[model samples]
Target: MQPVINYLNTNSGEIINSLGQHLTISFIAAIIAILIAVPLAIILINHRKIGELVLQITSVIQTIPSLAILGLLIPLVGIGTIPAIIALVLYALMPVFANTYAGLTNIDPLLMEAADAFGVSWRFKLFKIQIPLALPMILTGIRQAVVMIIGTATLAALIGGGGLGTYILLGIQTNNNNALIVGAVLAAALALIASGLIRLLAKVPLKYLTFAIIGIFTLAGIGWGVKSLEFQQQETITIAGKMGGEPEILINMYKDIIENDQPQIKVKLKPNFGGTSFLFKGLQSQKIDVYPEFTGTVLQSLVKTDKAIPHRPRLAYQQAQKLLQSQYKMTYLAPMQYQNGYAVVVRRSTAAKYHLHTIADLTQFPALKAAFDPDFYQQSDGYPGLKKFYHLHFQNVKTMEPALRYEALAKGKVAVTDGYTTDPQIKKYKLVVLNDSRSFFPPYQGAPLVRTEFARSHPQIIKSLNKLQGQITTKQMQTMNYQVTVQHKKASQVAHQFLQQHGFLVQKSSKR
Candidate 1:
């Protein structure tokens, strides 16, 4: 209770801003869905034949997983509000459109014919008769859409669409129950508010309800306009980040440096961009200029070779650098000193019980249950390779989101799980990381990856970025992650403080 209270107090401004974003996203998406779905429903009502197909198409879209839709949109729209809004609009369309189509098509033929016999305009007939009669059903559809959009809007954070989900994602990643609950509660509250407001319309006079709806939209528009002003710019340099605390911090650091040093470039950050493959496509399409990437990920996934590389960070970085340059016209910048490799971790109690100290110790526990993130589960350095190298097999190997794995281990749900060496949760949960004696997992030293052309064009920018080389250590990164995830600090604030403390960013004295 104290943690939750402290979280709310500390993050009040952020929560307010996130609430605005969440509402804005859901409202706009519902509006867009309404605009399209209602009009299409009207058109289709007259052409009953095509209405079935249109509703079915929208129904199919609703069936697609929200995360999958967001994933599919990232390569196409390159993350942020655009992709998030597009996906939400698609999700919102089904309920609103289906109800609208049903209401309009199910209208009495006698009334419509009377409206026709009155020599009224199709537009007039719709507004005067069809729309008024369909108002209840239409409003119900909108209410459903608004509520649905509120829920789906949380996923917006996965693709850099800032909302309450920011707190949720960070909380899960950092294992902060307070932040997660706060975010979840806020999102749910917003949904309830939207539903209650729409329900209010049912008890009001139709004319007043029309004005109330207009007023709601008008206020939403104003809120959106105000928020847009804060981020208004024709950004030239877009720094992207994959999902996770480390990448977000890196992108924030990059944004701070570039905007401070090269103001003319108009830097922007697209955080929570999809994983390696998605970001690779974004770079190829010029949707992103630069992003933080891991050396092992580049070598294993992007470069697409299973050939073993040198274990030393410098050697591995050089190998990845040469390969990326030759094959993809991409360049790797100076590596951050920290290595965020996969840690085969177990609860301290489990480690003590099994006398586990290294990967070889894991071989003794054939019945151990292992869990990992999807990417790790499929990667070369993941379960399969680890099993082959160490001649060990877990009784069960489960794949889940990286964030959930720590919680699972903490609850003793699994004996072992994959983890990043630099995750703060490792310290929080008092876990033991088995030493990779066999060197099964590759070293994943953090580094920035950029298009070769982009790097060449901005040599000075590259020079400033190189200042970060070998700056962040494993402990420093873990603490920073803890600060944001556990302490609820802003990523920009955390990054700025780190840079200033380390002499990378000099603080300007305030004028009296």
Candidate 2:
């Protein structure tokens, strides 16, 4: 079994990485949508038919499936946030534009006639009479648009945007109910609170006196909220997490601590999820307070030195921690029981036909096609290294989400694919996990990367996390994951149940 830390880190990190991409794209798109929609609204204000057509177009944009929309945009704009932002912006256009148009159109013609009678310029009538009267309604539209974008923006992760949706994606793929519940609930709450505040402001009768009062109060409230969520309370402690794979293990465990543990501590998630380069950058930036890290990965990426060592688990743990402490001022905490490293997965049929028992045997084949997780870093020491060391290369290398990759591998869309050594699908799919003959992929010992400041300020957090050491066997992690994804339980509920069953938490609260 691999260490518990590695298992969690590998699983949970992908969620945050995806989420960051999702949020960045959504917010930018919302802003662009507001900009484009408002001007178009102003132009079509007097034309009822054109205004209707604009609304319909926006509605149509909203109707398309979000991933489909993103895919459609990718070819034209390429990968990452620009195309994603455009898609989200198109989605957000209707509410703002529609409301603005309605507010403008609803303005009394009598007022316009009266202003014209006094030789009031058209610009003056629009700026003074129409706009002033329409401000509240336009704000209402904006409020609606904001809410829509917040929700729809979750899909931005499918492309390459970043935001809060990271948790949602991880929770979904790993079947971590707690992660999902937290993500979904927070998203809904954010939208509700944001929209509610917008409504309250819009409701205030337009007055110069109220504007200053409201602005001051709003700013104060924002400051208060930020401080409240920050300025760690007596119950608060920091948590660090990576972007993909085993990060889930630690996150779920931390989530369980927050949810069901005794002497509760509020969790401040310092999530650092991104691609390999991105995660290393996050580590350099100190954006992450703690994260699950692998032994060999630490050696290869951080040390940038290759010292051939015996394939011993304890040595991997010691070496990984040593590098983190000396180089990063990061404390490497107690490792979890289970470890997750690379494994070759293929259809049950392929395994049987080829009689493939190891990476070496599979290399004998020609025209290899494989799928790898895009978020997975160190494909070099893992899969790509396997290729180079063994002198094997595939004809096709497809990159996709881990979830989608399974289906492709199963259907023979690809001959073999990458997988977690412990993923339960190895059982469910009846797939084969080929052995590593030379053991070229060094042991990926899992341990928590604890920031020095956090260790000083909240040592208890480490001790609390340490309790799960030797608890999360690969098989255990796999089964728990199955309960959530295949069985479709809520991530929060599953985490709580697992903690209780494992005796990590006593007097467990019944599932909510």
TM-score winner: 1
The 0-to-1 C-alpha lDDT of every candidate, in the order given, reads 0.83, 0.68
Error of 1 at 499 (Å): 2.4
lDDT of 1 by residue, 65-164 (tens): 9888887877677866788899989988889998988888888999988888989998898888888888889889999999989998898877667888
Best by lDDT: 1
Q: Which stretches of candidate 1 lie over 4 Å from their true place?
A: 68-78, 106-123, 202-236, 259-271, 284-288, 346-358, 361-378, 391-417, 429-432, 486-490, 509-512
How badly does each model clash, as a count of residue pairs?
0, 49
The total number of steric clashes, by the backbone 3 Å criterion, in model 1 comes to: 0
